[model samples]
Target: MSTAKDPGKGAEKAHGKPSAKTPAKPAEGLPAKILSKILPPAEAPKEPGEEEGEVPHRETAPAEHGPGPDLRRLTEIARALNSEPELRHLLDLILDRIVDITGAERAFLILRNPEGKLEVRASRSLDREEVKKPTAKVSRSILVQAEKSGRPVLTTNATQDPRFAGSDSVAYMKLRAVVCIPMIMRGRSVGLLYLDHRFEEGAFQGVDLGLLEAFGAQAAIALENARLLQENRVRQAELERSKEKVEELNRVLREKVRRQSAELDQVKQVLRERHGEMKLKYAYPEMIGRSRRHLDLLRLLDRVIDTQVTVLIHGESGSGKELVARAIHYQGARKDAPFVSENCSAIPETLLESELFGYMRGAFTGADRDRKGLFEQASGGTLFLDEIGDMPPEMQSKLLRVLESGKVRPVGGKDLISVNVRVLAASHQDLRKLVEAGRFREDLFYRLAVITVEVPPLRDRREDVPLLVERFLDAFAAESGGPRREVAEEAMALLSDYDWPGNVRELRNEVFRACALSEKVILTEILSPQIRERAVPRSLPARLDDRPLKDLVRDSVEFVERRAIQEALARTQWVKTETARILGISRPTLDAKIQQYGLEKQG
Candidate 1:
C-alpha cells in the first residue's frame, strides 16, 4: 500500500499567504492543527466483489458517478448556505459541505482581499497549529487551469502531471488527485474552492466536479448578496449619525435666533423709552432748578440714575419725592420697562399686600381676574413705594424677602413669581427713627436705602420760588386762556417772606388760584388769606371809633388803594406802563386809581 503526499507542507510565507507561483497549499499555524484534529481523512469506496487485500482498479471506474446521491447532498448543502447571511459563517458552511460532499481528504477556501490578492479565508482537514501558520503555494499548473478556463480543474495524478511533475512544491509534498473550482460572481472569478485527496489517484470524479461547480455558482451569488446587504447597513448607520448631528445643529441655531430676537425687542423698547425721556426732560425742565441745593440733589441723581441701586427719598410730603424717583427711573438702564408707583399710606393695609404682590383670580372676594402686582408690573423697571415708612411691619418683612430674592409670592397664591424691579422708596418720616421705634424693619430700611436722596423743601430753596411761580403762572394762564398776571411788589415781598408750610405743592395751588382770579396782576388781596392777613400787623386798629362798619371798610379800602398806586408809580419812575404792571392793574385802571387818589409821581 502507498501513502499519498501531504500538500500542506508545501512552500509558504511566515504569515500564511502564498506567493504568486503556487496556490491551494495546506492550512498552517494553530488553525491547521485544530482543523486536522476535527476533520477525519476521507475513506475510499470498496470495489464490488473485491477481496479485502486487493487494490481498487480506478482506471475501470466510470468517468462520472450517477447524479442521485450527488443531487441529494447538493440540495442539503444549498439549503444550509441559503439560510446564512454573514459572509464568514457562509464561507465556513460552504467549506464544510465541500469536504463532506466530495469525500476529499482536505479542503480550504481562498478569496480576493481589498488589495486584489488571494488570501486563505477558511480551511478544514489540517493540524490546528498548521492552520495558524502561513499559507503554502500550490503547483502553478493548477492555478492556470482554474483561472484560464474560469472553470473547475481536476487532476487524477498531480505528481505525474507534466505541467507540475518537476515542481518542488508537488515533488516534496507528493501531492496528487487535486480539484480546483473557481467561485464566480457576475461572470468573474472572486475566489477559488480547492479540495484534494492524497491516497486515491482518482478521488474526484465528473459528478463531484459538476456538483461543486454548481455549488460555487450559487455560493458566489449568496456571498455577494450578503456583502451588499452588509454594506447597505453600514451606509445607513452613517446616514443616521449624520442626521442626528444636523438636528443638534438646528436646535443650537434656533436657540441663537431666539436669543437674538429677544435682544432686538429690548433694543426697540429702549429706543422708545429714550424718546419718552426726551419728552419728560423738556416737559419737566422747571423741576431742574438753578438753586445750589437743587443742583446738589441733581448731582446725586446723576451718580445713581444709571444703576439698579435702591433709593430712599427723604423730604417733606409735598417736596417732589415722586418727581425725583421718576427722574432716576427714566434715566436708568431699565428705562424701557414700566415705572409703577404705589403709596403705602394711600392704600388700606388690608389691600396693600394684594396691590403690591398681585392675586389669583379666586384668591379672595371681589377678585374678578388675575392681577399683576406693582412689583411684577414693574419688572425690569422701577417700583416707587411712596410713604414706605408707613407700610405695615408684616409687609416690610415681606418686602425685605422680595428685595433679597427678587421674587414675590402673590397674596393667596402658592407660587413665587420672579421679578426684576428696582425699588425707589420715599418717606417723610425718618426711617432710622422708625427702625429704632420698631415700626419699620431694620433690614428693610437698609435694603431700601442703598442710596438716600433728600429733596429740599420749597422754603429751603427760596431761590426756586420765582422760577416755580413763573412756571405755574404760565401753566395756569395757558390752561384758562386768561391774561398772564404779574405779582405786585408788596405781594411778591409778602410771598417771599412767608415760610411755606405746604412746600411746593401748596405754592403751586396758590399760584394757580391767584393766576385764575387776578385781573392782570397778583395783588396782596389776591393771595391766600394766610399770606394776606400775615402781611398786615395785628396791632393795627380793628375799627376806628366803631363808626358804621361799612363806611370804615370803604375808607380803609380807598386808603390802601391810594397807597398802592403811589408806591407802584415811584418804583416805575412814574412810567404809566411800568406803574400799571407793578400795581397788577391795567393802564386805564392805574390812571383812574391815580386820579381818584390825587397821587403824584415821585422824583
Candidate 2:
C-alpha cells in the first residue's frame, strides 16, 4: 500500500521507502505471538475486498465502522481512565491502552511540567509494561509539531517523509508509522500522546488517529481531577494543624490571667494589714488624757478613722473639736493629702460663701484672681468646718448641696467642681435644737452626723487637771527658757476645785499666767482671783482653846514647809542635788528635811 500522512492541514502522499529488514523487539507483558495477531506484517498482502494503493478516508471511516471494534475499544479505555484517581497509575494505563489499540511498538504520554516544558510522563510498549529509554526511542520533531499547532501529526513512513527528514531523533531511531496527537482541554493544548513503529510503514491508519485524539481528551480530564483532589487534601491537613495551635495559645492565656489575679489579691491583703498598724501608731498623739471620758472619745475616734464618712463633733467652744478632726485625717488613708480648717462663725456672713466655695476674678469687688475654695483645696483629704451651727441659712443650703453631691460650685463660677474631701463638721451649739427651730437643715444634719464625737468639758473630768497643769508648766518653761515652776498644794487645790467653764483652754491660760508671774512656787496669792474666790474655805477649829496657841502656829508653818519640800523632791525624781537646786537649799539640808518628815519616794 502507498504511504499516507496527516500533517494537521490535510492528508498527503508519503514516498514509498523499502521497509527495514530487521524485525522490532516485542513489547514486554504481551507475548510475541499475541502481538503478531494485533499488528500487520511489514510485507503483508492486501485483503481481497481492499483495492491496491487505496487509503481510508478519515471522516468516512468512523461512520462506516459505527459501534465497530475500534470505537468500542476507545469507549472501554476512556472508562478505565476516568475510574483511576491516582495520576501515576492513570498515566501508565493511558500509554498501555494507546500502544495496544494502535498496534505500535512504543507509546509515550508527554505532559507539561511547572516550567512549561514537555516531559514524558508515561512510556509503554504493546506488552503492557513500561518502555526503557522512551525519549530516545520517540520522534521529538513529531511531538513538538503536534504540541505547537495543537493538532495531530501522522506519518506512515517517517524515514522517507520530507517533512521530518532533518529531525535527528527520527533519523537515528528510523521511526515509521509515527502518530503524535495533542491533548487539548479548555481550548488549550496541555500535553501530547505519541506512538511509533520501527519496521512497518502504514502501521497506524487515519482511523486510529481519530480514535487516539478522542482518547487523549478523556485522559487529560482525568489527570486534572486527580491533581485538584490531592491539593485539597494537603490544604485540609494544614488547616487542622493551625486549629490545634490556636487552642493551645488560648489555654496558655487563660492560665496567665488566673495567676495575675491571684497575685493581685495577695497584695491587697498585705496593704490592709499595714493600714491598720498605721492607724494605731499615728492617731491622736497630742490628745493627752487618761480620764474615762477621754478614753471613750478616743475609742469613738478609732471607729471612724480610715473611713470616708462625714463626722459631726459636738462640744463647748474651747473643747478642741478641730484637734479631733486632725486626728481623724492624719491617722487615715488620706494622710498625705491636705487637712483644711474653716470656722463658720469666724468669717463674716457676706464673705463666708466666697471663702469656703471660692469665686471667679470678675465675680465680685476686690476679687483679683480666681481662687480655690476650701472644698477644692482639701480634695482627697479632709475639710473641718468649725461652729457649723452659726453658718448663715443661705450658706447652709449650699454646704448641704456640696455634702450630698460631693461637689461644689464656686461663687460666680458656672461649672460645678467635684471633690473627694471627707467633711468634718463641728459645733458648740445643739444642732438638733437648731433643726427643730428651723435654723438648720435637718437633711444636712443627718448627712454630717453619720458619726458623732462629743468632747468632755474640763469640769466633768477633774482628775485630768493635775496632768494638764504639768503639761502646761513644761510647755511654758520650754518656751520662756526659764526654770520649771511648781504650783503649791493650796494653789493646786484651789485651781482643781474651781469649775473651768472655759474647759481645757481656760486651764491652759490660767497656768500660763501663773507661770509668768510667780517665781519658784505658785502660791494661792498668785492664783486667778476667780479660782481663789470659788475655793472652799479652810475650816477654823470651833475654838482656839482646844489647842495651845503656840502649837497651832508652829504646826501650820511646818505643814507648809514639809509639803513644799516633798513636791520639790518629787519633781526632781528623788535626786537630792536637783531637789536642793530647785528649792534654793543645800543638798545636805534637803536630806535632813526628808528624814525629819519621814518621807520616802512612792513608786
Candidate 3:
C-alpha cells in the first residue's frame, strides 16, 4: 500500500495548449522514505526464459547466513498468516517474501480492481508519492499479456521497446527492464506477483522464473486466508447482532432485571452452546437399527468415553460406519474442533489428492489459486476417511507419508506443512485380502489399524432389533415434524426376525418408507412386506416345520444374500459400499453378487 505518486512528467506545452506531451507530474509528491517503510522489500523481476535459481533478500542475509535460519523465518511466515488481519498488510508481507525469495529488483501484487484494471495493491519499488497518484484506466495491457502467456515477459531494454515507452503504466512506474509472471488458479489468472530489473538490465533466467512461481503459491494461500478471515469476521458480527436482539426479547418476556439470574444464565449458556452446534450439520445419514445390536453399540460408546485410545468400528454398510464415526467425534475430546469426514470412495482417484491435500496456484494446468484441502481443515481434530481400502494405490503411498511425517504438502506446493490431528479410518473390506491382492498397501493398513472397532451386522446382532425398531420410530417421528407413529408388534417382530442383509442402513430406509406410506399410527403388514421373509438357519426352520434340513439351509443363504443386496442397494441408493454394508458383506462380495444376480440398475 505504498503512497508513491507517478514519476513521469509531461513536457511543458507551448501557449498552454494540449499537445502530444508526456503526462504532468502532480504538485505534491509522496516521499520514497514513507513508501519503502510501508511496502515490503521485494525480489528483482526476472526476464523471459530465465533460469530456475532462487532469490534471497538482502535484509534476510544478516539474520540467515545459514539455511536453517532462513527456513525458520519461512515457518514464521506460515504462523503469521494464521493471525494476520489487514489484506494490505498480508499482501505486503507476501510480495516482500516473493521478492526476497527470488532476488528481484522490485516486486508488487497487482490485483484486478473492480473496474477490471490492474492496480498496485502493494508495491516495494515505488516511493509513497508515486503510489499515491491515481493510475490511468488502461484497458487490458501487457499485464494481461503476461497472464495469458503463463511465463515471464522479459524486457532487456524497456524504453527502447515499442510497447514500453508508449505504455502509460510502464512509463508511470518507470520500468527499465521487467520480468512478470501471472498468478494463476483454477484455469484463470487472478493477478500478478512478479519482479523486474530497474537497477541492472538483462532478461531474467529460467531458474529465477521458477523460483518466483514457488513464491506465487505461498502468496495465493496468504491472500485466500485474508479474504476468508474478513468474511468470517463479517458473519460473526451479524450473528452477534442477531444474538443481542434475541437476548433483548428474552429479557422482556421473562421480565427479569438482574445482572445474571440463575435460570436466565442457564438458558443463555444453552443458547451460547447451540450457536456452535449450528455451524456443523451432520452430513452422514441416520442408521435404522433400534434393535439389541445398537444397545451393545451404546454400551461400547459409554465404555470408551474415558480413554482417548483410537477405536476402530468395523461394520457392514447399513451398519452405520458414519453414525459410529459421528458418535466418536461429537462425544470425543476434540469435539470443539472440526470433524471432517471424507468418503474415500466417493470422489475419483485423480481428484482425491487435490481434494484431500489441496493445491497451489498454477500447480497444474487449471489451478487458479491455492485451495485449502480437507486434511488442513480437519487439523486438531478427527479426520474420518471412510472406505479407506478403496483409495488408489498412489494415494495410499501419499497417505502413508502423511501418517509417517505427520505433515502434508499440498498439490503443487513448495513447502511441507506439519499438522496435529487424529485419523479415524474405516473400511468394511478386509485389508489383509487387499494387501494379498496388491490392491491395498500393507504399510498403510498397519498404520491405520492401530485401533480397530468392528461394527457387527444386523443379522449377527439380532437381539438388538427390537430396540432399533423403537429407536427408529421415534427418530423418524421427530424428523417428520408431524404426529408420531408406532409400529405394530407383529410387524416389529417380523423386522427383528428378518435377516438384515443391508444391516442398519437398510433398516432406516424401510422405516422411512413405512412412515411415508402408512397414514395410521401403527405401521402395518403392507409397510413390512419387503422385510417379511426373514433369513434363518435352514435347520431351525426345518425343526419348526418338520421339513428337510439341507434344502432349508440352501434356501436361507440365497434369501439372506438377496435381502442384503436389495437393502444395501436401497440404503446407498445404489452406491457400492452401502449395498455391501447392508448385507454385512465386503464390497467385493457385494459386487460379485450384484453381477451374478444382474442386480445393477438398468441403463
RMSD of each: 25.0, 25.7, 34.8
Each candidate: what lDDT?
Answer: 0.69, 0.73, 0.60
Model 1: per-residue Cα lDDT over 144-252, one tens digit each: 5686788677777788777676667778768877888888776788788877778887676433344566677767766777788789988999999999999999999
Q: Write the per-residue lDDT of candidate 2 for residues 272-367, one digit (tens) a residue.
A: 433433233345667866444675688788878967899999998787888898999998888999999998899999999989889999899888
Residue 545 of candidate 2: its Cα lDDT?
Answer: 40
- For all predicted structures, in order, the TM-scores are 0.43, 0.44, 0.41
> What is residue 37's positional error in candidate 1, in angstroms?
99
lDDT for model 1: 0.69
* Candidate 1's TM-score: 0.43
* Number of the top TM-score candidate: 2
Off by over 4 Å in 1: 1-288, 535-603
Model 2 has a clash total of 0
